[model samples]
Target: MQTASGDTQSRLPDTIVDESALDELLSRPSPALQSFIKTVSSPLVILGIGGKMGPSLAALALRAAQAADHPLEVIGVSRFKGDGARPWLEKHGVKTISCDLLDAEAVTRLPEAKDVIYLAGLKFGTAQNPSATWALNTLAPARVCERYSRSRIVALSTGNVYARNEVSRGGSIETDPLTPLGEYANAAVARERIFEFHSRRNGTSVALLRLFYAVELRYGVLVDIARKVHAGEPISLATGSFTCIWQRDANEMILSALALAASPPAVFNLCRPEIFSIRQVATRFGELMDRPPRFMAVETGLDLLGNPKKVCDALGQPPVTLETMLRWIAHWVTTGGRNLGKPTHFEVRDGNY
Candidate 1:
């Protein structure tokens, strides 16, 4: 990563806006970011921006554009462009373009760009469509990257790319061997391969963020666990160590990585400073909610992973603390957390990660 200096504030063109409000995007400056920074121009495109992380990511990009004094034309893509994500995006002035990304034709013909934040994925739990998941998560990005090789790409990957035991290897380095345990990880792995093929072929400067757990009140494992316990449901435990970061912190980490992409096809584990145990998480949630967290602890051997030392050393702050994360989920559940939602890949059972 480049030495992010105070001059970053000054060298920042008239377009630079105060990053105080956009904490997630401003927390760190990646090597790719500095490189992307020098070349900030309008017509920025965020593929699959109509989904989960799109709104926040787009907003942050605009802020970066504002700081640089370059007028940014942000395009957010998805199946349809209204209601679901429209409100959140419009609140930040991000433009939307509707297209069912999984349709190869639509994805193939999508406009090329300067910077593309690829965030679309079929990322729910086992209960989702496997083929659909494969197509959306890995295949689509691979295709999109091929079409837009000229654009700087930051494809979101998961820490799942690392095998379970590999995570405990003093921080699973990006080069660790293939050990994806489930369909989700398999898809992510395939996506990375696709990027590699195109990168070598077209010299695409792409960054694959092997993100770990990103927690927020409404999403992730903690929230699901909280809802189950609150509703008096029985939970099972899995055996594995895991890592987590605040959603905002992960976002900042990603933005930083974007600047550092040029140093080869880089993979940075996006997580918090602490590696947590399943027991600790369960206990924490129980304490905060003032409810007993019931569970049958068993070994699933899944990779309950954590430890984000790399990014912490390079960037500046830890995403979310264990205590704060628990508190946030607890408060959210009490306010109206709802059913465990449609069990995402992160629905917790017992003490497993």
Candidate 2:
């Protein structure tokens, strides 16, 4: 692993045995992250800390703070709803608050902080109840921006905001249009627009990160492919290529991006620079799990992808590689490791999810 000060270290585990081990791995801060945490002020507020990536991200920030011996207090706010994330975050020394972001008064009553990380958004089930998705994706951000107008905010957005592009073009750059396909994607664009409006109006410094995917052992694009291959299900190649960053790397970059926040709201596409072929990834998983993979559909030559050059130039390339991720995910799946059962639905070109 590469530290923020540009030092090299070996931290990758051979295999993740269970959730405990997996959480530790995900929450472990890299040297780069530890170094960055020192610069952050106390009471780093993380909104929507009850989602799939929230607990580990909060833990990573806390671990980084501890490593730097910085007196940084990490507070995570979410409705929680009895999810296992609240307990895990509390156990990791992150202060937890149960509050619905949609309640304007509830958001106003939250503690104050100069630095904030926004992670709340709805993607799946958008087709079933799009009004809920729009309210959460658009309204919640509006409230957060209004409350944290003076804070340096790092907000999570999705690459689904971009229209499909040719594979030969590498991927959609940060300047690409936001005319994406479905309700979920349009709502995501509205989320970004809301943040931008608030930032411009209030002179708030903000960074918008359009992340493609964040992969880990339990659930992600990698796990989705690995499970299908292991079960001998036909994999689709219609959306032939995509991009992702390891969850840890994504968390670290998101924290580090606090420095990139600015008036007018700097935007960056967050993911590994390399474009990955779905067919190749499935075949690699098969080799690792000793299973022959089945495939269906053909490459459409158009897919939703992101170009990470801007962010990679600002922060270094993510240290974790594709081979390491494949090895870790394959081992976890074959060993009866637990899965979150939440598919990424990466193949959905219609942007339904």
Candidate 3:
């Protein structure tokens, strides 16, 4: 498969042997990203840098800056409660500031930056403690938007904000309704609303990216399916189709999205344009891992999917192909590679989690 940039799938490594290699792969900046970094101003502040995608994202921005010789200072802010992401970011030359975004005063103390990437949001434990999820999703954005009222902010939202769409209808577009099920999804909508409100009121330039899923070798929809196949576990097909982009591609586009920020916040669905079938992907993982995948549920034909045409038109289609991702994930699973133990729960049809 050829990427939007004309690069072929053969350029990707056959197998990521370990975490070191995986980190390097995820943080590697593309040529387009390097050029984009040149246009970004110094002191790029990335909020919630302790999350799964945050460390590598901060590193990717720093790497792009280095490649472009832009002399950029990448600052990552998060509640660094012995998460180890702080040290990893520090090792990558990203300045780390420990701050709880829920505290408005601390948010004000954050260093000024013309460009900010908001990654702070809670999702996993929403079922148990919906209040925390709501507070984090709603409060953090309010504080950050207030603190960075004049900055260009690229906030990461989720595809969960939209209800599941018919498989034949492609996927949900940006203008689709935000009527989703479950507390987590609703909270995500609130996060976007807060950013939109602040942008409109303060004339803040903001870009809200509704990302479907970002897959790397460790933990994602692909890894979930691959591990199920490798472990002889049943792969659920209740949620038939899904969408994902390589983490590197997602992070690069996220950084590039700073250019898309505008008053009232420009919205874009972030994912590969192609919709992936759960059965097809699981079966392919079975083939790659030399294990037959077990099936449990039937396909509902409705899923939480996103169409990336708008973002792809703005920033080129993600370079990593589904086949490449499947191959890499299967290899990692069979080799007993370490996983984050966090399942994407992509099969959930009710938006729970």
* CA lDDT, every model vs. true structure: 0.64, 0.91, 0.90
What are the C-alpha RMSDs, in order, of all predicted structures? 6.2, 1.5, 1.8
Candidate order by lDDT, decreasing, is 2, 3, 1
Clash pairs of candidate 2? 4-32
> Candidate 2, residue 292: CA error in Å?
1.0
**Tens digits of per-residue lDDT for model 1, 281-312:** 77677777787877775646555464556656
Each model's TM-score, in the order given?
A: 0.80, 0.97, 0.97
The worst-scoring run of ten residues by lDDT in candidate 1 lies at 10-19
Error of 1 at 266 (Å): 1.1
lDDT of 2 by residue, 1-353 (tens): 23333342266777888888888888888777888888898899999989888889988898888888999999999999987888878888999999999999999999999999999999999989999999999999999999999999999999999999999999999998889999999999999999999999999999999999999998999999999999999999998999998998898889999999999999999999999999999999999999999999999999989999999889888878899999999999998898998999998987786
Q: Is candidate 2 or candidate 3 better by lDDT?
A: 2
Off by over 4 Å in 3: 1-4, 7-10
